[model samples]
Target: MKLQDQPPLHLTYGLSIHPDETWPELWASIQEKALAVRARVAPGKAFGLGLRLRDAVSREMAEGGNLRRFRQFLDENGLYIFTLNGFPYGRFHGGRVKEQVYAPDWRTEARLDYTRRLADLLAVLLPDGVAGSISTVPGSFKPWIHGASDVERITDQLARAVAHLAGLKEKTGREIHLGLEPEPGCLFETPDELIRFMQEWMWPRGRVRVARELGCSLAAAEQKVRLHLGVCLDTCHVAVCFEDPEEALRQYQAAGLRISKIQLSAALEADAVGRAALARFIEPVYLHQVVADLGGGRLRSWLDLPEALAALGSLPEARAVRVHFHIPLHFEGGGGLRSTTFALRPSFFRALQNGATEHLEIETYSFDALPGGASRDVVESVAGEYRWVLQRLVRAN
Candidate 1:
């Protein structure tokens, strides 16, 4: 038998590690942090950046002179932004974010307007012939959707955004897309749930609105919506929900859904014996949704680690629990703690090697929430993760 060659990998590696809350501060952080990572990780090369623009900073970046100024900075530094973390619309750090992160969800005009601005900004930033993607919230927070009106509102809003994106592509001659990211407790926690929402509500409702708005046939509108909007598959989120990344990828592929990007990250996991170590991760800054498998396909969840800990005595003991803590790719926990990196099987990497998705990001956004992360040099830590992923890609080839 003869060996077949692997297809060429058109992959880009990055870290969505920006944590600043203001424009000047963010610019300084990018100039310092992004450049330091580049110098250490891909010296003298085009380093791909996963830009995190807060709502205020997004406005600032769009204002006069700043956009061009930032583009000049990118040119000088040999850094390129290939993706934006659109999930955070405001105040990402230095305050308690919690579930408020999912506010102004897909049901509102605010979410649609903000997403449209990002699409406009990304279309300008993307290099010629390079497609762009923005990962956003998965509809609304699970607890907030009270009835059919909310679902209908979100469906119509997203369809409007999809229509706007199609118009942007036609006007700019660039393809900038939106990827709804699913979290453990969000409206669409699992790939199965997300696809169900898409087929049942989004596709059926979106096609009509999109077709009417674009003055096109229903079939063309569905195709356009699918092309411009898709899944931003976050490995950590899916793993924390007790789902395998490869299996989720297979599900997405089977459903005729597009994977706009893949956030390469790992979640923390521990069995009954290692449960004590999870206490160190409880913090005030962000919500860390926890999911536990109680055997026999029975699963339970809590909004945060503390709630899970508080209810542990009353509920049946779980076989294992996974935390939505974005652990560094290179870190396998000691002291009875482990990461869900094991869930990233060989098939996932093989799919990447075959261009399953064009965008790959090292999204350790919560490194600061990890134990001793504040004292660690984030740029150096991210650079190590960049090496970890690059080496894996090399070995996979």
Candidate 2:
């Protein structure tokens, strides 16, 4: 599928390497791992690389050179710079890597300073033509979504950040696109709220807000500031809100806002008594099916999983069949069989064949937040899972 009016073939899928793996040794290991991954994909299907930054400042300091090297790594490895992670913000100095807001006063001067600094760093490392995703900026949290900041202050914060980003664009001569992700707990939670913010306040050319009313469109009220913001589709975040994945895609697509990124991850499906009961547990409400091509040599052969397994035959071209998978780890403990884990369903595999989505990014970064000791193993597990899916895709197509 084409996005940003770009060619469809520019589509690709990338892996987000955890921030913990940013060090030299781990970074090298990740390169080796990713190399193995690249060797498996078809010749012309473009792919990319995603770098997750834990603490922007710390990464700038400790891994600055490493960062540069990583960019070179991307080139050497045939991967494009996909995303620069900005989440669980805070320090990663020692044990207990904390997630804190450096800007406790998001409405005041602190937030601007932080934003400027971050924009500055990102501009340097991420030049222009780079697409970025911003999640849970300090003021974006809980009560904030419920009428949190006064109009003047929120507007100011947004202005400064936007200005800084714009300034970076001029300096770099690159059209860096920012996807203002509407997360579940942030101030700009829903698509409606975010879209309204963009249309009303931010992008109106000249708009300035003096009063922040519950439903007042910022642009209608102000003439000094205009927002140039767009949307970032985090499937898991949307899924948790019980929104239909396909419907969400269509809505945003209709809105004319960029689909910054389509985060591919499984949503949890519940173990229930029936279909209705089970429906409540689907995190994304719906998930994309994994499509692959088996050795049968064809352009692309589409087939459902169980049926394909049963009707094994040779093909004229090498193509892939898609399969659906759900996310959010599910486990059970009872009946004298206490255990914790996830379940893979074949039907989930059947669903992906419905769309023409070209680019997809594997976003299983939540594993980074797992209990302390499990980081490495968890990352490896995710890698293995992706490889398994890729193998199946290869076989089916």
Clashes of each: 0, 51
lDDT of 2 by residue, 35-109 (tens): 555555433433455544444443453444755665576566556644444443543323342113323434657
* Cα misplacement distance, residue 386 of candidate 2 (Å): 5.0
Cα deviation of 47, candidate 2, in Å = 4.7
- Scored by lDDT, the top model is 1
State TM-scores per candidate: 0.95, 0.58
For residues 290-383, write the lDDT of model 1, one tens digit per residue. Answer: 9888999988899999999887656656888899999899997877789898887666787887767778888888888889999898888888
**Model 2 regions more than 4 Å off:** 1-29, 39-47, 56-70, 91-139, 144-148, 204-228, 271-359, 368-397
Pairs that collide in candidate 1 are none
Q: Pick the candidate with the highest TM-score.
A: 1
Q: What are the C-alpha RMSDs, in order, of all predicted structures?
A: 3.2, 13.4
